[model samples]
Target: IKDHLKHHQTQTTCWDHPRMAELYQSLADLNNVRFSAYRTAMKLRRLQKALCLDLLSMQAACELFEQQALKQNEQLLDVPQLLSCLSGLYQRLEQSHAHLVNVPLCVDMCLNWLLNVYDTGRSGKIRTLSFKTGIVSLCKAHLEDKYRFLFRQVASATGFCDQRRLGLLLHDSIQIPRQLGEVASFGGSNIEPSVRSCFQFANNKPELDAAMFLDWMRLEPQSMVWLPVLHRVAAAETAKHQAKCNICKECPIIGFRYRSLKHFNYDICQSCFFSGRVAKGHKMQYPMVEYCTPTTSGEDVRDFAKVLKNKFRTKRYFAKHPRMGYLPVQTILEGDNMET
Candidate 1:
């Protein structure tokens, strides 16, 4: 089965594309690969349906098992006995489920009916989650508002690095449905069809269902494990020291979305992002940042960027009430690569 899944992923489709990393994470995490189904499209589709159906069936099975077990378990055991019983039961459940589909039809039918209850909410969520991993697919699929909230919450609760990576991926995947948009216009099948149009933002930028993006990052152990703090510590000992940014990276900007992929601190570059002044027609003095300052300990980040903000704050105020006609705004950290 695994070999078949690998074959389909490599030979039949571009499943290993970096663009599909999130979806890859999903398939790998759930051990949800289906090998035999790839022999035929019809069989593959049926297998997916059966898997979903089995998820539902599992819920009912769970309840029935609990009820039956309860009757046998009428007599309560001491703590040690209870613990032993639970361990054995959990193992049995796993083993039984593994063999369920291989059993005779009469037995399988009964199991499916029982398991259906558990799979109820699982399918929609799994589908929604799987779609999110597919870059533009979630937006192209026109996910509803609820999934949006789910995506946001998961993103927020997720640890920093994983969250950071997911954000980048979501931004990248936004291009998918867009690239196909021109092709979709040829009057063939609408890749970004009307049904999926709801997932898009009229203004561009794939903002449809970040939930899948959010869920993928959170689920990956890489998200929280080996965090930046611990990572830096290990690096310090290994002598392959990591470079640091002159400016602080944690501060937020009002009315601006985050851009964390590149360095944000006093990162210098020949490819300048700033126009050397405040934004045109804006009411704020653009601050001039000096990147030669010492590194911050990250203890009180609120004060870490105080120097830059203070230096630039006046320019921002001056831009508001200019002696001239329109306000000229200085550039913020809009540069591409400024980190030295």
Candidate 2:
């Protein structure tokens, strides 16, 4: 099965051309591989239907298992645990679902079900920690011999298996639905909402060595893992040992600032913060603070380039103000006092 999956990944099919082009372009590489479009489309259509059937079969299996467990008065651990139950449910579905002429491998079917659960209410591929935890949890449930072998192939004790690794594991065994391409398009910024609860922000840059990443994956309540802080540290190390502002990746004369307690080491120039610059996770409500300045007044110093950068970066702010010609004319007869 592993050999078959490997073969499948390397095989060229018509449906893959578009995605292959996109992938190759992203890496600035290309190949002269050609394939029969009509034949590939037909194969893809069949594969698509097979994938849908497998999903429906698994969903039915899950619902049936839940009903039986409920009748037995047994309480499941958590969403992850409930999902791990897919391993036990697949066997029952195979025997009952005669219409499923093309049954995917048991492990592939179960892993796909788990992936569906992890991707719920979020976009992008599942991160390494969540992926590793889910697979290990399923293995602990005591799956059949063949199923255990497949799961172990994709899992490791040292670290998480990324999507590329998973793709290789299941590539030939089952066809990935086109919908997966759309989900992948959403990217990392659309991480699962519950997963976001795992980390808290910091006021200063963080130390994100390999050890720190492993500890963060342990999900310890007291372990403080600030992503922004780690990002700053990584950027500094890679970009010629200089820490660029998070908002504008340039030198910070006045220093960077951040407002969110949920964020750490996420520095932005004073200009970007005060002028209402906004990005994916950061917003205006978070307050800003200055760093490495001798005096408080120096923190407020706004450079010309920084100010201009903020103006363009925050066009939405300028859009709200009315034109100067529309200003209300002040009347001397008004009850309110006016200075001349």
Q: Tell me, by TM-score, which candidate is best.
A: 2
Over 262-329, each residue of candidate 1 has an lDDT whose tens digit, in order, gives 12233321012122222233322222222212334662263345444544445545455332211111
Which ten residues in a row are the worst by lDDT in model 1? 325-334
lDDT of 2 at 28: 21
Clashes of 2: 2
Off by over 4 Å in 2: 1-48, 51-62, 65-84, 99-104, 112-188, 191-340
The 0-to-1 C-alpha lDDT of every candidate, in the order given, reads 0.27, 0.33
- Root mean square deviation (Cα) for candidate 2: 21.7
Off by over 4 Å in 1: 9-150, 158-173, 179-340
Return the TM-score for candidate 1, rounded to 2 decimals. 0.18
RMSD of each: 22.7, 21.7
